[model samples]
Target: MAERTRQNNGNGKHVWRGIVIAILAVIVLAAFISSRKGEVPVRVDHVTKQDLITTISTNGKVEPMENFEAHAPAPTTVRKIYVREGQRVRQGELLMQLDDADARAQAARALAQTKAAEADQHAIQSGGTQEEVLNTRSELVKAQAERDSAQKNYDAVQKLAQTGAAAPAEVREAASRLTAAQAQLKVLQDKQQDRYSRPEVNRVEAQVEQARASYTAAQDLLKHSEIRAPFEGTVYSIPIKQGEYVQQGELLIQLANLRRVQVRAFVDEPELGKLAVNQPVTVSWDALPGKIWRGEISQMPYTITTYGTRNVGQVLCAVDNEDSRLLPNINVTVNVSIANKKDVVTIAREALHEDENGRYVYVIRNGHLERQTVEAGIANNTRIEIMNGVQPGEVIALNSMNAGTPLRPGLEVRAR
Candidate 1:
């Protein structure tokens, strides 16, 4: 009875092991069949002939084509503000006014100084002042009269001496008086003739010029204290309150014509070569969504400069803002259209692949994916121009439906 029981247990162990092995073999075969027969659903596109435009995008700023800025001409207080921010003003309209009392006082003082300097210059040129000239004339007349009197007395003394009525010593004293009077008269005449030297005249003239220049500058400051619009524009900025004190050269107001504007685009140095004058450009501001402003390149950069972390060139684009929506100094995005090709064979950019052998695309022909080497031309953000190897109406794989599934030639695929 014990031997029979042992024999039965051994048979049962063998049977159970065989059954487990059979079940595992069936699962492995089923997995292999499923993988082999699975079809990779992919996104596909049809190659077609259409217009394609190539563009490059970069950051920019909106600025007025005609702009004006005013600063404090002298240290003063803001007297009044005629226009508020965002006010539309005509040319020559008053915008703001500074406390011009000090400027006027300075101008008046300068004018007085100029007048005084001019009087001094005139006096120097004319040899002497009116009073001094009159005094000298009076002295000349007195000296002449004394000389004549002394001469007459000397003549009388000579006659008396000849007539033996006067002594020789008296006649000699009369001659000495005449000589002294004549010397005094000669000194007065010389003094009138050369009252000032050449250097003295030059010095006075220079002072007159300096005073005149100072007066002119003072007048200019006074005029600038009353700010006026240089052209028809919109006032965009006023940095001070009506009663605020400001220093010379401090920013006061800013204005610009909102009818026309320019966008200054900062393009990276590598993309500078693709830029040219008259190229179409589009600008969009983040502050105003869904609004686009169109323009053209007005000026090209002559030199490259560092902008943030990029070496960039500044390109100017002229835009029309007739509605006056775009404001100055606003940040915006710019797209420059470099090239436009019409009616050309094109494909989605994702369908074009590049490798060591150059550019290629997988085309769907007769219900199977076929890899074809391609020659490409210009490309834009979403599409690429295929010069050859890919024809119109051919379907190409954009991407695999299952992520990470490799796109291979001869793989069976169906559009998702």
Candidate 2:
């Protein structure tokens, strides 16, 4: 009986060991299958022959062709404004008016003074007329007749003194009076000559011209009170209201021409050499997405700008706008195509990689990843041109991979 019991215990132990071994084997198989399922799958794309375009992209703003600020020319109170903000205006259209009552009064006074001066100048230029000359001559003749009578008396007195028929004191008094009369006659003759040729008249003529110029200046100021638009444009802003006092050079309104818009963008110095006049460009505004406006490079600034660790040069592009949607200072994006190539080997931009040895890519050969050194050319945001070391229809890995990542040239790979 003891021997039988020992045999049964041994048999039970052996059966238990066998069952445990089978369960371990099943667990190992299940783990191997789960590990295979957890492995990360890589994605890839194929190189192909297609047209490749290289473009430079940057953000910009749309600005009007011309922007101007209108200011008050002189200090005055606003009388009336004909237009409001955002109003369309034509060249020479009246915009605003200032109280010009004082200006008008001043101008009138200046004109009156100018007219009086002119009349005085005309009279001076044309010296005394024939009648006035004759009148002066008559006065001179009368003075001469009186002087002749005095001279005769003096001559008679001298003869008496010589004959000793009168006192010497009386003869001396007569001689003094004769001398005064002759001096008076000479003064009259000189006065008559001055009437014909008056030199002072020319000085009066200069004063008249000065007064006329002042009058013209006052008239111009009065006209300037009625402000007019300088060019055809839309009114952007109106800062002044009627009865508001504005100083000289104060902001009154703003204007801009919206028909033609320009995009001002900056380009790096390295890319500056690739830009030229009339180069084709494509522009899109943030306000109007999916709408590309075609344009050309209109101007390139000669000087470079330095701003907070950035060095760039300015480039201006002229865009045509038929709908007049583009306004001043609207942000935009620009794409300038620098070059294009056709029938070129190209791949997605994600396929290219860089390291210490320079640019490289991974190509699949015989179902395995193979390292490839490539020379790249013009690249756009989507694809890059493969200049050399690659061919068309070749499979390339899209994502980056490690060098010692257990990849073989001919090993089978399941591209995700």
Every candidate's CA RMSD: 9.4, 8.5
Count clashing residue pairs per candidate.
Answer: 0, 0
> Cα RMSD (Å) between model 1 and the true structure?
9.4
The superposed Cα distance between candidate 1 and the true structure at residue 166, in angstroms, equals: 9.6
Clashes of 1: 0
Record all residue pairs in model 2 with backbone atoms less than 3 Å apart, i.e. clashing.
none
lDDT of 1 at 393: 91
lDDT of 2 by residue, 1-416 (tens): 99999999999999999999999999999999876653334578889989887888876677778877867767789999899877889999998888898788889999998988877665544435556667767877887887898888888988888889878898888888878888988877766555334457666766788888889888887987887888998887787788899898899877888677788877776788888888888888777768878888899879999744768877899987666676667777888888978889898898888889898888887656778999999888899998999898888877534334444344445576
Candidate 2 least-lDDT 10 residues: 400-409
lDDT tens digits, residue span 304-386, model 1: 99999999999999998887889998999999999999999999999999999899999887667899999999999989999
List lDDT for all candidates, in order.
Answer: 0.92, 0.80
In model 1, which regions exceed 4 Å deviation? 1-36, 144-179, 197-203, 403-405
Report the Cα lDDT for candidate 2: 0.80
lDDT value, residue 167 of candidate 2: 87
Question: Which candidate ranks first by lDDT, i.e. highest?
Answer: 1
TM-score, predicted candidate 1 vs. hidden true structure: 0.82
lDDT at position 335, candidate 2: 80
**TM-score of every candidate relative to the true structure:** 0.82, 0.69
